[model samples]
Target: MDFDQVRLHLNAYKENDQVIDAAKYLLYSFDLEHENFAGFGLRKAIPNLFLLITEGELGEPQKVMIPPNLFDFDLNLVLNVIAHEMLHVRQKSSINTVEDKNEREFQAYYEMLFHKVFPKIPNASDFHKKIFADKAFEYYRRMGENSELQQKYAAQKKEIEQLISILL
Candidate 1:
């Protein structure tokens, strides 16, 4: 959906502090760096809705595509996905290996869940909480404490904490 439609829907649910906070945070974060990338924008032209991140062809423009269906999608979930992808951008800037990319994505997904998504949807089902918590714990354990991986994880944790505070 376009920004206006999204704003209208959000205004309709204005009394929902959690929803309002989540939407504001997502929009604010997107605004901070959405344009620096080579390609970035919401795409309503496809059948299967998705968020796309692509490298520009022949030095063209890199982009991020957000499908229109995202407006009807869960706000917290969509924000988490966007935050996770944004973390990927950071990871791309620092890490080169496929393994590192996967690891960072794992960490980003956890960070988004615990910090960005969970606070906005505290009443999520027990199963949902268990799944994310388990994955996060598993990722942390695999990184091993006191290692560089753990240090990066800790930094991400701090960043998540700060972002949460800002949104709250």
Candidate 2:
């Protein structure tokens, strides 16, 4: 879908140069056009976050929700947040299952933590770093301690790690 056509949804569609510029940059840098998304949308009243909305029989990604004020953040930070949500879009469309929420979070956060592209950005503030530490390492730390959850998710973790390598 054309990024220019991203729906304003409930938002009153005021023209924002920042959103337009960032959309252009994202289009150039990522494989967004072919994803199984219904479209992109803008939400004005919600928290300042991006979201991937899923639907249909398999719960695949249907649309990406962008807060209208998202572009007010630092550009790198804005891109990173959008990239994170896009990763969710990819995970939902490719995996087609809502199960393994932990695995999914792990994979996405792993990318944010270790991937070369994601790591060099200066916008990953301490708050984000804290979440990355707490959530991303939860399963790996458990496995190291011999938690049974380790056994439950071992193969899946390995698969996700491999996928992370590819995504990186």
Candidate 3:
């Protein structure tokens, strides 16, 4: 999917999904704030206060960054990537290390699952396919052996699964 297609789907989804709307607002706001910083020479004078104000429910990330080659990927792959990014927007944090990166990814996947962004897989026949469920742990190896992050990831995984179980 290309940028246009992503925007098309997002426009549709945004009609009913407030999450996307809020994300766009935060993203655009951040962009405008940054532009002002450069335009008005405020980059070092003061921090972006809107960012510091909304700390937990929303953090640093405002926009979803898309690569130049996203148009080459399959639609499902593209959607999965978008979902992953939206999750990051939903739960951004102060990323300062590799462990932080991995943990954030795990959290994004958990958020995706909880939000039902994952495509369903019913038959065991297609188990080997690169479906959302199959490729969920593709980034896990980077997590290393950090037991605390692992435990947090596992607990949240289970919690999200249980929540999914109840809702679905």
Candidate 4:
């Protein structure tokens, strides 16, 4: 989806009917140096986020930075990425809590996952797909060979679910 399409969708979203008016987040590029390594948020968050913290992080030439060395994906992925950040724009909450942060990331990632497809975006690396994949692994309660990673994943999932239940 292009900018207009995303705007239209966001404008018409049933759950987020007031998104256009009530949206309280600033959509910024990866360049300007913010808290999020890929994209940042306050609360209503989730499980996994790619934190590319290498030296010499250059800004991609767009409103939202695409991390030139990372993915150059298509309109939907880009829009979803934007939407992910938008989802982070919520009323002031005590995000200092780890659970709150995970909840925020979890919700944003779930929304992003809901809109993603696993096709090769033209001229873009697998970075977009990889991002989705990482989120998927977290969201779907996936298991892997690495015991330590699995344990950490399991713990995070437990906390995420616990937080969701409390929030609901």
Candidate 5:
């Protein structure tokens, strides 16, 4: 579906109004499609997410889960995270291997950092860097050394760093 239809779908939830607004902004600003999404809503306990194939089938309706804590963060940060999860939702089908999973995450985080939709969010670049250095990169670092996974991880890490040097 188109952006307006997606906004209407999100508005119909009416449970997390702020979240719906953020989702709407991301959808409109990025021109992301809504046909694959079942809906968007708050989900407790689970981390912010999009329902994945592992939870069911790729053909099953998928929902984006917004962590309630997002209300405590910056609007820009919230938008970026929601955008990241939405990218996950869009790419949920491409994850068939651990390497593919890492690549998807890298892509999402990369988009989150540098999609050029909105103007730069104050400190958002720093925040994205920390997420990569502390979590995502760390996870990849722990993988078996010199293995294909580690190699792919290293390559992505270098690529992101190089891009960041040029962009930020």
Candidate 6:
């Protein structure tokens, strides 16, 4: 889907004008200039899985995969999911390793939910923080034990933090 379709979806689920306005701001914050970045699309491969698959082993453009049967899924929910997956693609390009995959996913989910999406809706960040914090701690704890993974995670984390600090 294109950005306009994504925006339409966002508008459908978002009733609050203020929340929608904030989401528009967040959407603009995403790195949309990347050549590899594409909007969401539906697939029939899985029954109910909404996956975002990137090209190649790494350093590939990201593709958001949504099941065709997402009629029941809320529009903003799908947008957030796509945003989270795109974060993973960004992390993967910066850090190379299989072990870092899980950590990157955790970091992306946490950062997107807490830093990006939370400001858009009332109490959304507060509710998601509890979830994100637990997952971030677990990922961080694992990274501490795995020296190689720690190095990779730290590098990617620093890169992401710097990018966010500079751009957002």
C-alpha lDDT values of all predictions: 0.50, 0.52, 0.41, 0.38, 0.54, 0.51
lDDT tens per residue, model 4, 1-168: 144544454445424433322122213321212342334222221233322211222232112222321222344454455555444433112233223344445555655544332212122224554455457456444344555435655654555445454444
lDDT of 3 by residue, 7-124 (tens): 5654554466443343344334323222111111111113221111111233344444333333333443444445565445444534432226666667655544544433331112
Per-residue CA lDDT of model 5 for 1-168, tens digit only, reads 253654455455444556656555556665654455666666663445332121224545457766545444444465566666666666664443223566656666656655643333223557555564445555555555677767756766676677557655
* lDDT of candidate 2 over 34-132, digit per residue (tens): 356555666554565544343333355456666656654555455555556555666677555435556656666655555443443333555565555
TM-scores of all predicted structures: 0.46, 0.56, 0.39, 0.31, 0.59, 0.50
Ranking by TM-score: 5, 2, 6, 1, 3, 4
Find the number of clashing residue pairs for candidate 5: 0
lDDT order of candidates, top first: 5, 2, 6, 1, 3, 4
The top-ranked prediction according to TM-score is 5
- State which candidate has the highest lDDT: 5
What is the model-wide C-alpha lDDT for candidate 2? 0.52
Q: Which is the winner by TM-score between candidate 3 and candidate 5?
A: 5
Task: Quote model 1's TM-score.
Answer: 0.46
Instruction: List candidate 5 stretches off by more than 4 Å.
Output: 1-18, 45-59, 68-72, 94-100, 116-125, 162-168
The reply for model 3, stretches above 4 Å from the true place, is 1-58, 67-73, 93-99, 110-141, 144-146, 155-168
Clashes per candidate, residues 3 or more apart or on different chains? 9, 0, 0, 10, 0, 0
The predicted structure with the larger TM-score, 4 or 6, is: 6
